[model samples]
Target: MLKPHQAKQAHGDSPNPVLSINQMNLVYNSTRGPITAIRDLTFSIRKGEFVSILGPSGCGKSTLLKIVSGLLRPTSGNVVLADVEVKEPRPDIGIVFQQPTLLPWKTVLENVLVPIRAMRMPVHEYKDRAHDLLRLVGLGDFINHYPYELSGGMQQRVGIARGLIHDPAMLLMDEPFAALDAMSREFMMDELQQIWMTTGKSVLFITHSIPEAVYLSDRVLTLSPRPGRVIDDIKIDLPRVRDVETMGQSMFGEYATHLRALFKSNTAPSTRIA
Candidate 1:
């Protein structure tokens, strides 16, 4: 395994990226004085690429996501999306968090239409799109069902549908499947890959699971422990259309092993939660 400081560096920004995170740093003033969450972090997500982030807990994975989503600003550096600097929440991007955050009273279709309504677009025009997204996520038969009627996995399916309703330029997922049981998490990984294959939207996924990240992403970016920096930008060369069976392959284990080693060597106190 490469040491944290010696891991492969990110490539240059030649081909235009859909999202560019340039040497980002974030610091907070607290009772303990100044705390740095990220340091000199830099990366780029090309059009239609699926990239996953892995690091120790409190390593600013979610913080980086928020910066890219325009919900939070970085203390230094900048995030540029589609040639425009992201200064505020963008209408062209969608975010799915660990929690589905669905409204219990609303039906699945209604929840999927939330973005459309929030954007002040005619809800009627997006009704068909909502139904199609639900179907794509394998919830066609449950459109009218309420969140209370669904299981944890099903509700997350609804969340995925909701995120895609706007036909956004990029999808930002912050461990969207972290709450599910093992079987369901694996199941959702497959579903997400299929959805990505069909839509070809750029994705920036944050997760602690090495296997999950390696299985779903075209590349995986491993960050150092807090004051996070990109230590490794390893490419996943696995064949597309992967399924659960793909996990049985040697290369799959190789990729997962490499990530685990990076974490073990990168973080001080020498521990990884997942």
Candidate 2:
């Protein structure tokens, strides 16, 4: 378990928080007994910030996102997004999961419009926005293509476009690149960073990769093992518009090394973030 005091000491004061999780806790009712998935996990994401949550599998990383997305209710505490308490799903929020989850029958452009349709928004109004987002994700030429016709990376790009179709203020990404090959994963990281930079959307990304978290995040939140707690909140001071070359720099290695050390000390090596 992480010592909250150490976490607070490491991150002396938080910036203006766009989302706040205060003393959050979650307990699962199992056949055996109650299982605590999270205990007093507290943190915040500031406006237009790219924050990554790093932790082991089954560490309530996804659970935390669910709560933040208003898909699930925490046993205690609350999640406030943009000063609005997230009691239920909100139209301004978007999510992209590990899998693309695109409708195979739907064209890339059609997939992007799913959210707008579900929200009962004027499809005509968001049609141009959808096309613009697809272009932003480098899928303009493939808008007519179906999911089956696209590569894994391209499909994930469609997922991202769909997430942004509604012009959401905040995006919740749950390991969106975890399913890709290492090369593709790295490529998607670059694309994602560029997209985030271009869109300026506040993002809360959940990932198990230490390097990915360090490379893509403005701040990395390290969580302890099961019954997760915030162990460390380290700010990445690297320059923006980071490219593959940035990965080879000394500072990148230092951040990766520091996070590796934290995982080794706080959680099992087998489930290390990297």
Question: All candidates' TM-scores?
Answer: 0.94, 0.93
Superposed model 2: Cα runs more than 4 Å off = 1-13, 269-274
Question: What are the per-residue Cα lDDT tens digits for candidate 1 across 77-182?
Answer: 9999989999899889999999999999999999999988998989999999998999999999999999999999999989988999999999999999999999
Q: Which predicted model would earn the best lDDT?
A: 2
Q: List the residue pairs that clash in candidate 1.
A: none
Report the lDDT tens digits of candidate 2 across residue range 24-116.
999999998988889898888888989999998888999998898898999999888878899999988999999999999999999999999
